[model samples]
Target: MVIAVPAVALFCAYATASVTRHLRVRSTGFDLGIFEQGIRGYAGWGAPTAPLKGPGVHLLGDHFHPILVLLVPFYRLFPGPSTLLIAQAALLAVSAVPVTRLAIRRFGTRGGSAIGAAYGLSWGMQRAVGFDFHEICFAVPLLAFSLECLVDRRWAAAVAWAAPLILVKEDLPATVAAVGGYLILHGRRRLGGATVCGAVAAGLLIVEVLIPAFNAAHTYGYASGSAPLSGLPQKLLTVLMVLLPTGFLAVRSPILLLALPTLGWRFWSANPSYWGTEFHYSAVLMPIVFVAMLDSPPARSRRWLPAWCLAFAALLTTMLPLHALADPGTWRPDRAATATRAALHRIPDGATVAADNRLAPQLTARCEVYLFPFYPSAALRPTWVAIPDAPSNDPRSVAAREALPSLGYRPAASGEGVLLFTRSPDR
Candidate 1:
């Protein structure tokens, strides 16, 4: 466990620094703005921060995540989206603590620490770190901590920790129910049955009763929206992505069954996006697989398994783009990045602004920001606009770039492959 702390600390620091650099370089894929704005709203500091996730959608409507409220106070002190990134890093690293403790109890300090290091460096965790913050940061560590409690027979603590996942996302209820199933199988019948019932009740209440109650769109995003039979190859590949780091040994343990909830949802859904290993969708599965690996020791037990796990992680870490996130150089500024910053300076404080996904977070702190197309320009009547050229321009940005001039917004400035447009003063 000792090595786990420092290793996780370093991992968190790397992620925090990388995200800071991402911000400076005008890389907005990290979702810093979406969360920064949302948390800011929860803190009562801004005109409800609107994330650019979906059109005509409230931030709450994007996902039934009240967990954003928890981060409000931290953001109050630090007051940047980077705070969320750093918090996410710290929270994600924490899953290693309980996991390391479990390994230590079974394998002794040295061996357990090695396993913990592998868990800390798992591809899903690393990818999520590079991908930026997600609410799953809370869920990952909570799952680890709660599962550890279950392993140690601390039923109350496990239930307490496991219950809050309902606030994380729509899909977590099933994951929580699986945790109850684990308990029931292990002979804790009452707690197990109770947890299952509570999880189901909470999940239903949130999705069916609570969230849809306030959603502007009057809908919630529970399914992956996948069409029939198309996602099989992607599903198969995603399964490989989950187990390849541990040499596919995570499958041996019954604890690995916990991943089925998330896996089934992702694979069956029509959302082709969920079929890939990128993003935060698979974040919770990492700890499950890794912990299961620790629980089901190899026959030889001569350090072979742990060593192989670490080596496999190291090789993949070197090859993946996420490894680039560990370098401060990844955050260094470029022309388009600088130009976007300069364009922001031209817009007045508190003016309504519309921006592409990558540029929205930068403007969230000072402006009343709206994500383009999602919040129509006619209603937003934004005084200023920023559009990153080419790749960052999703359909919304393309439409805005074409429509802005006709809407009486003319070019204010252009830089970093982004065009800055302002509504004509006379209008």
Candidate 2:
């Protein structure tokens, strides 16, 4: 079963990669940048020097997944973004094996297989795993292990297993709290200890919030400022779509009676700001629901629910190839990378550059770069600025151009809506 999981994951990953590859050559830049960042961070090079910013350490970012940090050393040795991405894909797929085991423990082997397949091929899982270097990919396996331990009533083991999850993303502490609360409420005594451990794990989360805050304060000269939260609704819709299959089964399954409320509370209370930014954080709870639903006593009327879900998923996967071309943005990495590299080559080595928020890190990896909105302590002023053509008409872009003179910056070069700026010594 374990061996089969990787095979299945590899197949799905390849399929996703194939689709994404065609979306645009540059879309892969984010994934590649993440891998590059990991490799650089691991090697003690290109990592953000300020110690705590972005996904590696902040609110809506991941910080606790030690596996990724550990992977850094090995990544340094191996040295290729594609290699890490493939490995991540394999691990994400292999997580289904334990999920299957948990399902089987709750349901029969056949039912467990169905649940495992659903989880393994879940859109959320597929999208996340398909990406090159998300920390969530590593956390998913550990989360599955924690659930397995919980089901076995091994509270100590569960808590210990969940330790790595805390580091993977900041919001995970809330998940730990949720699971720990469930254990304690269910009259599991050792769960008290686990709850305490989870609380301790949460203490580590301060780094996520604090580091970002510090960076914003020190670099941007403000403790807080507004960034667009435009995608919250879309993110929520995506979550609903991803969970539709499991949600349908939950409604019909008695064993999952508690899950409906749990899931509802989770989604309802979620911070709107975090919705789209880190949607993958929801992966941890997915298997628990799958296990509960599968384990429930047979409902004669609803026996076909799992089959229906699988059939629906199969249909979607089949049709994905047809729509692939229409969704150019789906090929994000390749397109983004090509664009970024082109922009990079035009900038002199060590030239300070600022990029669109999406492209900033990629550019940062290739050269000295800063984020727009101008961080006050950014290591250097940008001589070139890269903006996506699509967003050039945005108010922020206009505001940035307006603000440049005030900040002692002048436009130097322009390409495809991206502008390069040089600091004017006579500001």
Candidate 3:
């Protein structure tokens, strides 16, 4: 009851914010739309073909995540991008359960509730919820419960919980291997050895074989372009940020070693986005660090640790999206947002649309949507193009608009700064 109550409360809070963002057209197609397209395919008993990726890009080609099939049932029941948003909220909120239960065992009920609430509102979880959905949301809870099981000395359940992570994403195999390494250190040699070997093999097979097999180029798309040493300063700062909420106490526990694989890959990646304290990338690490804090067991004199962590999280929330919930203005759509939505409705159902990044999610449920300047084929150009009227400094947006006239589209609808173009029937 202690855990469930707080978890549910977080769910409602997260769901309200995420769903509100979608309603106000703040969601982007690159993620929310793309993910919805993939799930939509799954619900129809077809491959997770997200046209938003390209003409017929199998999403598995882009990333190995068969675990997404689990959402197909829920998406089928309540179809649309909001379903994914709500599901992400629930997944992230539920992760606090194992972390909270473990904390309650270590501390008393009040301390446990504080730590749980802190975990739920931690900056990592806040960034993930504020941003769009990602497969990493599933990893958050899986890592928490698996670590909790490890804390309880339930070896089989720990392995069972951690094993599915590879199916969540290729990079997660390394995390799985780290869990196995923990088992080995704890004297569960045989189980740990099997786990490490299985995780390595699965990671290699998926990254080298499965993803390449489905990828349009017949190779792993993200196999190269990383410079691990290129961003030393930013990477170090991010590590500090991850530890700050725990007042750096989590480092005392060996379980903090679990964070290595995730941090390793992100730091090694060339993308700067992975290196910073942004997006859904770090949500999985919150549980590991918080659990490690509990395992370290502060001295009785330092019983204020959990409360301090909660205070830090609460302090940071003012800079995060959750702060919007306290403001009355967030509930009302701005004039531009309302006008943009009105313009989007001008496009017909089932028509192909090359949509602006922000406009894509609004039409994803009803239209065959693609990101502007990139569609399936030149031979099958989108019948409608939707974009904001205000000048875009983006080179792609500039180039796409320049080519619109030559590609045979004319103005069909216009709102404040929103514009919709339709291709001529003769063309």
Candidate 4:
């Protein structure tokens, strides 16, 4: 049954993308195109997405996520938008191996299998797998394995697993340090001290030096506004989302402290995107919470507790947007997707094209793709431009549609609310 978990996750994730909608590609430029474009740059192609990122945005410079460089070889081998999506599924699924072991140690085979099922079916993992591709995919497994090692008291392995976290994202060093802190509090002073020191130093260096040096913007740059934070109510609610799924069992372990930095970053973010239950930002928290639950069950009072928690978790996912996408009624085929496909077919291979956020991922493999508002497209002078007839608030599409003619583009084709524009020469 544990063997079947990854397959189910992969199928559900792949199906969600193919069926309900390409939520990953369709959203405003959150991060997939950025990663794909960055990987293309890392793989030695030009970085056209840099212009939309802002002036002088190198791949590592843009977000300080150097981990994408590791994907270069994979991209070289299999260059396409789905590469990241499939890679993300595998990464999330593989975390279950260690989680399964943790459960086995706590309870005998049958009970352990139940724990593993719960861990795999948990709302967070399901939501994350369906959430398109994200760098957090890497973080999720690493954090999950690290916590598993910590729970089993595999000190060396724990440190080793946690060490690579610095490369995942700038904010993760704080989680690493929290792991070290937990170790120290548990009486492993030597290893714990080293972990804390290294994580803090590396984190500071990345944020203050490496990131600024790479970025043309020359600052941490995430601040979307001047408001410090919305308030405690949102913070409390955000914390509730993490705890409620596991019946608050996760709080029973020291590992719960590991979530603070990530939670803090979101609740305190000036950008409202970080403040909500949506997106893959919280995927990393899922494994930590589940592993902590494995630790929560006392020998006598807890045989049934894990099962109850698992049931609740599996139940919770039904209400989540991810699993809900599997419903045929909710998924009803998308007409715009057909139109988007037709419009994308018109662009020839390897030509530069500016497309809307939704269409950008599809065109990225063959074209040097960029987001619209043409000027910011790194002066590639896109040979073609595609704009979805998006709603008023989708500024990228709306702006691209209105701006094309002024920039000397002519409407060459129209279908299912998609408008394709081309230069006079191409026409």
| Model 3, span 199-286: residue lDDT tens | 9999999999999999999898887988799889999999999999988988998889999999999998998988999888889999
Worst 10 residues of 1 by lDDT: 47-56
TM-score of each: 0.90, 0.68, 0.97, 0.87
Model 1: lDDT equals: 0.74
Q: lDDT of model 1 at residue 207?
A: 77
lDDT (CA) for every model shown?
0.74, 0.54, 0.88, 0.71
lDDT comparison, 1 vs 2, better candidate = 1
lDDT of 1 by residue, 1-427 (tens): 3846745664555465556555565446237677767787877754333645543446666667787787888888888667777788788877888888887776778777777877777778776776656788899988888877766678889888888888888889998999899889989889899989989998888777776766775666564365647867778888998988677777788889889999887777778878888877887988888877766677675457768877887777876545666576665655556666776777787777777667777777777677765544565567887766556436755665778777888888766666788888876
Residues 1-427, model 2: lDDT tens digits: 5436534854565446633442333334344554455455556654423111332222222233334556666666765455565666666776777767766555556665666776765655655544435676766777677766666677778777766666665545555665566567667757655675665556444453444453433232222343334455665674566457565554443334323433443445435533442335445456655655554435562466557656655555554332353466554455444654475467676565666555554454445444554431334455566556454566766787677677777666666445566677664
Query: Taking the candidates one at a time, how many backbone clashes does each contain?
Result: 7, 30, 1, 0
**Model 4: how far is 154 from its true place, Å?**
1.2
In model 3, where is the ten-residue run with the lowest total lDDT?
Answer: 372-381
Who is ahead in lDDT, 2 or 4?
A: 4
lDDT score, residue 393, model 3?
87
